[model samples]
Target: MDTAISPELATKAERDDLLTLGVEEEYLLVDAVEPRAAEAVDAVFAEVPGELRDGVQHEYYRTQIEVASPPQLELDELAAALLRLRSGVAAAAERAGVRLVAVGTAPATGQNARIVDNERYHRMRQRFGDLSPGQGMCGTHVHVSIPDPETGVRVLNHLRPWLPVLQAATANSPLFGGRDTGYASWRSMMWERWPTVGPTPYLRSHEHYLTLIGDLEASGAMLDAGMLYWYARLSATYPTVEIRMGDVMPTADDAVLLAALARALVGTLLHEVRAGIEAPDVEHPLLMAAHWRAAHDGLEGLNIDMATREPRPAWRLLRQLFDYVRPELERHGDLATVTALMGRLHEHGTGAARQRAMLASGASVGDVVDELARATRGEPGNPPID
Candidate 1:
C-alpha cells in the first residue's frame, strides 16, 4: 500500500479558494416508541423524489439517514435545497410510522443495538468492534471547494484552529442514549475516538502530507484517503476543504448561519494565501483541548489558544470570528441573516441549552423528542427557519 500523494499531483492541483458550497446532514431514524437510528433509509429513499434520491444515502446504521446538498453557489439556494430534502425525509418517515429527529446523537438506544451487516461496516466492526457501533451519531458537514490541492491542504491547515469555534457555535447534542451526557456537542466526543480523526497535523509541504498519508496507510491505520477524518480536511473526491465539526442544527436558519460562516472562513483563508499572508498554525494538542471544551461546555466554557496556550472566553472569540468573517458574509448577501441568527443563538442559547432548559422545567426526554419532531416538521410552535 504505497499510497503516497505525488508532489507533481499536488503541484498541479489548484490552490485558490473558489466559492462553491455543499452540505451533508445526518438524521436519526427513530421508531415511534424508541428514538434510535432506524435502519430504514432505503425504504425512506423510495419515497424521495428522483431528483433528490441521488443525494440521500444510508449511514453506518440502518437507523440513520444522510442527505447531501447539491453543489450550490448562493447561500439561499443551499438553504432551500436542505429544506426540501428535510421535508421529503420527514414525509417519508411519517408514512412509515417512524420519525426523523435532527440532533447530533440519538437518545433512545441501549448498549445492545445491532450494527448493520454490510461489507465496509462489517469490516469496520470487525476491526474496531465496540467503537464501530457508536458511529451512529449525526452531524452537519459543510464543503467549500478550493481550486487546487495545495491550497486545499493549506486552507485545511489554516482552518484547523477554528473548527472548535464552529463546533461550539452549532453544538446541539446535550443528551445521548436517553440520558443527559452533560456535553453540548456529544457528537464531537463520539467522533474523536476513531484513529486518524480530529484535526490534521500541520504539514509544511505537499511532500510532508504525502509522507504522513503513506505512513498512516502503511500502518493500516486508515483504509483509504476517505478515512483521514480530520475535523477539517481536504476531501479526496472533491477539490474542497470539508468542515465536519458542527452538530445537526435544529433549524434551517442555524444551518444557513453555519454554512455562511464555513464558506466565509474558507474564502478568507484563500484570500490570505493568495496575498502571501502567513496563516496561523495551531498545534493538534491545542485543537484537541479546545474541542474538549466545546463538547463539555459549549459556549459556556473558555477557549484555549492552541499556540499561546492561554484561555479566552468562548463568547468573546465567537464575536471576534463573526466580525472577522463579516465581509465575506456581506459579499454572499447572508450577513444580515447570519447576524440576526447568531444574536439569537447567543441570547437564547444553542439548541442544547434550550433543550436542557426545557427539561429543567420538568419536560421529559419524550417531551424533548416531541419538540425535535415538531421543529423538524416546521410546526408553528417551533423555531422559524430563515
Candidate 2:
C-alpha cells in the first residue's frame, strides 16, 4: 500500500484545517451471568460519576446506553475521553449489577428489549409496531464538522460508495438467539427493516437534499428528520456530516479507528469540492447490495466493489479506501494511528469473528458474553479486539 502524501500537499505546510469530530457509541446492558439483555439502564445511569454523566445517556431501549464524546479537534484527545467515559460507564453497570457489552446486538436466546419511558419512544413503538422491540441493536455514529449544509450534503454524496467498506470493518454482531446467525453484522440486517434506513440517494444540490427530507417526512416514510437513517447524512442538530454505517465497536480503540477514517474521508471530500471534483453517481441498488454483502461477510470474506460491480476481498477494498484518504490521514497526523489500528484489526479480526472463535473453542454463549463484558471494561482477563 503506497500511502505517501502527494507532492502538492507535501510542499505546503501541513494544513491547519483539521475537522472537529465526535463519536456516539451505544452499548448493550446484559446479565453478568445469563447473557440476556438486562433492563438496568436507569440503575446504571444513577451510578455514573458526576463528571462523566453528561456524556452518558439512555438509548431507545432500556437494554442500551449511549456515550457521546465532546467535539474534539485531536484524535488522541477523543481517544482519552472515550476510554474514560467507557470505563466509567462500565463501572456503573457493574455497580448496578449488570454488565456492559459493546456487541452490536443481544447474543442471548429469547431475550426481548423494552422501550424506555419516554413519550416519543412510546409514540415510536405505537407507530412502528413490531419494529420497536428489536430496537436494542447498537451502532456507532461518527460526526465530523462541516462548513455548511452544502458541503455536508456533497460530502454525503462522496461518502455513499464507501459506506459498505466502513460497515464491513465494524461488523460485530454474529450471535443472537444463542447461535451464530451466519452473518457478520446481524444488527444491520435488523436495522434495514426500518423504512428509512439505507443508502442516501444522489443529491443534485443542497436544495435537493432539504427537499427530499421534507418529502420523506410528508410521505410518512420517516416520522421526522431524525428518522432519516441513511448511511450518511447532514446531522439534524449538529453542523456535521454524520456517518451512521458502522456497528458499535468492541473497544474505545475501535471507535477511534472509525473516527479517524470518517474525519479523513470528510477532509478528503472537502478538498475535492474545492478542486471542482464531482462525486460519483453510484447506483442506489448496487449500494444497497454492497451493504448487505458487507454485513454478511465482514473482512473475512468478499465484498462488492462498487467501481467494478464485482466481488472483491473485503480487506482489499478497505485498503483502497485507506489509499483514497491517505493524504488527509497524513495531513491530520493520523497516519501512524490508523496504520497501527488497521494492523490490529487485521490480526485480531472483527468482533463477529472473535466471538465465533470463542464459541467454536468450547465456550458457551454466556461465557462469550462474559468475556465481552470484561473486554468492554478493559480488564486484564479478556484480550482486546477493538
Q: Which candidate should be chosen as best, given lDDT against the real structure?
A: 2
Total colliding residue pairs, candidate 2: 0
Cα-based lDDT for every prediction = 0.75, 0.86
lDDT of 2 at 6: 35
Cα lDDT tens digits for candidate 2, 1-386: 11122344333323555677889899999986788899999999999998888788899999999998887767898888888888999999989998899999888874577889998788777778877455289999999888889988888888988899999999999988888999999999999988999999999899999899899999987778888999998988777898998889788888899999999988998998888899999998899899999999988899988889999999999989999999999988999999999998988888888888888778888888888887777665545343
The parts of candidate 1 lying over 4 Å away from their true place are 1-18, 109-111, 305-308, 382-386
lDDT of the structure predicted as candidate 2: 0.86
What tens digits encode model 1's per-residue C-alpha lDDT throughout 1-386? 11122344344333332376778888877777655555666677677677677778777787778888877666777778788888888888877778888888876555544555678777777776676454268889888877778877777777877778788888888888788998998887878788887777776766777788888888887776767777887777776778987889877767877888899888888888888877677766778889889888788677765556788888777877888888877776778878887888787677788778878888777778778876765554534221
The alpha-carbon lDDT assigned to residue 175 of candidate 2 equals 89
Kindly report which residue stretches of model 2 are placed more than 4 angstroms away from their true locations once superposed: 1-15, 382-386
